[model samples]
Target chain A: MQAVEYFEVECPEALGGEYYKQIANDVLLDHNLLKVIDKLHIFIDPKVPVFVAVGLLKKISTRVRVGDFANVNPLEGKMTLVISDETYLASMLKIFWERFGKEKVEQPDRFTVILYNVPATPKEIEDIVVGDPSESLHKDLIYALRCIAPEGFRLRSEIFTGTKFTFVASENTLAEDIDTLVAEKFRLMGEVPP
Target chain B: MTLVPVTYKGGIFQHDIVVDLIEDLGGYIVQKHIIAQEVVLQCFVPREDIELIRQISRPLFGEVTDSPLVGTEIAIVSMSLEIHHLPHPSCDIAEYVRRLGAKSNMVSLARGPGKRIAGLNDEERDVINEHDIAVYLMGNFETCIEYKMPTLRRGIEVPIVLCGGPDKEVLERIIDPPVEGYVGNVGRFMRRTKEADELAKLDEIIDEITRVLEKKREEIAKDPLSVYPARLMGLIREQIPEILDVTSPTPLTVQIAGLRVKLPYDTFAERVKKVAIEDGITLGEVAEVLPSRMRDYVIVKVLPFSETNIAV
Candidate 1:
């Protein structure tokens, strides 16, 4: 069986460092992957109670295309979207409705939706604006990524977008060289370079 | 030879006491068995030496140092509608007692059978008296235990331990002839705990039961049997081969002096008479075989050889 890597992150300002740590520990233990040499970092910004957890994405099968998650077809005038993964269909539709108001959205089936007047490239639709990005949104995205990542990975990095903020998590900060400047700041916090 | 019932693992302490007490009294164990419940069934000492064995075991009585709740057979008297809660206390107490090497049970009184009506029923009364100890689990209200006392007031000469959620003092004040004592903290319905503090209360209950059994041992010694059951069983086994094949519900019952052997009334009498010793004296020559008083079973009692002037 292919090993799955899992990680979790939270913005301390939105959820708190202790909460993310508890969630991380719980998830890691539940998955029986605590011993893996994955680097997990929880970042707490002094300006706000922002906490972010970042870890590496360890396992991925190149054979399974991303289109398996949702249908990608280039149509004239706009790109059409059809989802085959029924489980994520609701969330995808919710995102679609938030970006394109309910009046403009059309759902023909449980797992099928059409985004009107969209670019041929589906990645552009993925980048469509829904809700304004906030610290909580970044934390939520990290949490979702942690839920999706395979279990074996140890290193990860999380970046906060507000004020051009960035957070990176990895197995070894010293070996990976995330940022020499950032390492100095972390060194002052008594964090040994790994 | 006598039959001593011992508990396994957790009951090691009590098992030692019972073994020592039996051997020290010059009583031999004819049969040994393990009883899972708090009450044990023992057939010890011949009919003639029952009083002696009782006397020897008297000193070990009433040491309730162990949890009063240990070895207690609780009857969760509740309605059919409340059957879900039956397992709650039984599992809780059973798990607690298991740690101490004891056992408990949760018995449900028949539906439409309140305490008063059920208390008067012969079957219910017999079951209540059958156990060495009983716990009458009541509801939260004081009146529940009070009103239910009448149903539980059968000929239960053994300890009747009470348990409910109410404060111990409040229950004591409300129960008129008050039960042995009320156990508390049985009301909390929550997750299982492995913490020592969580089990302390149950330990206290087990201690109470041990104390009560000890006291009973004292009272039983007041008038001991002449010959213990152990000696009688040995004599019966040596003399009667038919007993081995004669299967009755309770094949061996611990009597005051000798154990009672229940065999089929019609078929085994002749074979029982044919059992003889090396010198060729038959069992019929020493013991009397007559119809049992309570059931369609034969009752055998040892008659002194001197009385019959026979030696095998």
Candidate 2:
């Protein structure tokens, strides 16, 4: 298996080369995907009016458990969660309210949540999933790729997986030859076909 | 005499006094946006009478600020009204210009997509020419923008501003004749415009548009229009009360040479032509009333003193 490496953009159309690279970088930065993307490659041909992007995402094995963002402590009759990252506070409170009862969940401050009469242990509470970053990361990746694609290249096809993604867009209806073109493009980037 | 465009912002209470004062001063209210409690009136008041209107508005706790493009109309052109080209950036540009006080009309060309096949026809060009300035929102490619410019310049007489997604350097090299200015970073966008950088680019387009209008203003000053289009618009409103029934925004829409009354042409053209001024001279003698390019709206083109042998 080939290990993921770097990000690059190639344009046969001289004028679009630097412009495409700059925007593609911006879109990546905007989505905070620089860390998650191990390697990304984009190729554009303005004359043919085609846009293609292929990337390998760093694997994320763990879900965003409550413990990663908050400190869950078990009290005598209540469980108190002191959230370190306020980003997941709303979802954490909702999960507690749903799993326990709305009456059992009380938040006095912005980042502290207390739950009363909780049967679950600290480990169990800590195991509660707040969200999966990969889901939204995938979505943001697609959005960023779309932003980089030229506006008139409406016809699109995308393949998304746990660790890899490929998107190809064109002004015309994509033909079978496009797959061959994509393969040739990947070959140029020294990406071995699956 | 130069007319200044002013925006009056204040409480809605006793706002009619301000409106009445502007009307009495021969100023036309281009547009007024009123919520439950606040009102904003965009007015084109004569330079000599600006201080008078300001004094009235000041005592009423209303702020009067200059709105340079108040009565002017701008056409925001795009390739098509379809999902591919319309919403993302064109609508945002139109909304921004409208906020700046110009009456912005969104003009989408019939066959303005695909660089090889894109071309704008005469009618589309005429519609664009009617505005004080034309803003053509173009795509990323240099070749395509260069290809599209000739058709726009050939048919439209108004100054054109090319706004596109590419870098200014790339656009400047390609864009030629009839293009007043080139504004970059405004083309096809994927999301609702919120970025400060994107907004700054829109502001640049607005500034270029203002510059274009100023150039046209300087040219018009050489031999000014028969009457200030706004003043004529105000007169038409006062003389023809029937226009009040027209529900369109700015029923008496003003252009550089004339005004387009958004009333049915066949029934109202004769009445509009027969509108009399203070001299007992009818509009028919000083202007030509014809069917407008838009729906059945009547177009009143005020002839110059050289043509009509009458000056307002």
lDDT by residue (B118-184, candidate 1, tens digit) is: 2345555554454456766554334344655655565666567776656677767767776675676
Q: How many clashes does the backbone of model 2 have?
A: 0
Q: Which pairs of residues collide in model 2? A: none
Candidate 2 local lDDT, B99-122, one digit each (tens): 878889999988786565577888
List per-prediction Cα lDDT, in the order shown.
0.48, 0.78
| Alpha-carbon deviation at A15 in model 1, angstroms | 37
The candidate scoring highest on DockQ is: 2
Q: What is candidate 2's lDDT per residue for A34-143, written digit by digit as tens?
A: 77888778888767667888877888766789889888788788878898888778788788888888998899998898989887889998888888777787788887
How far off is each candidate at the interface, as Cα RMSD in Å?
Answer: 23.1, 4.0
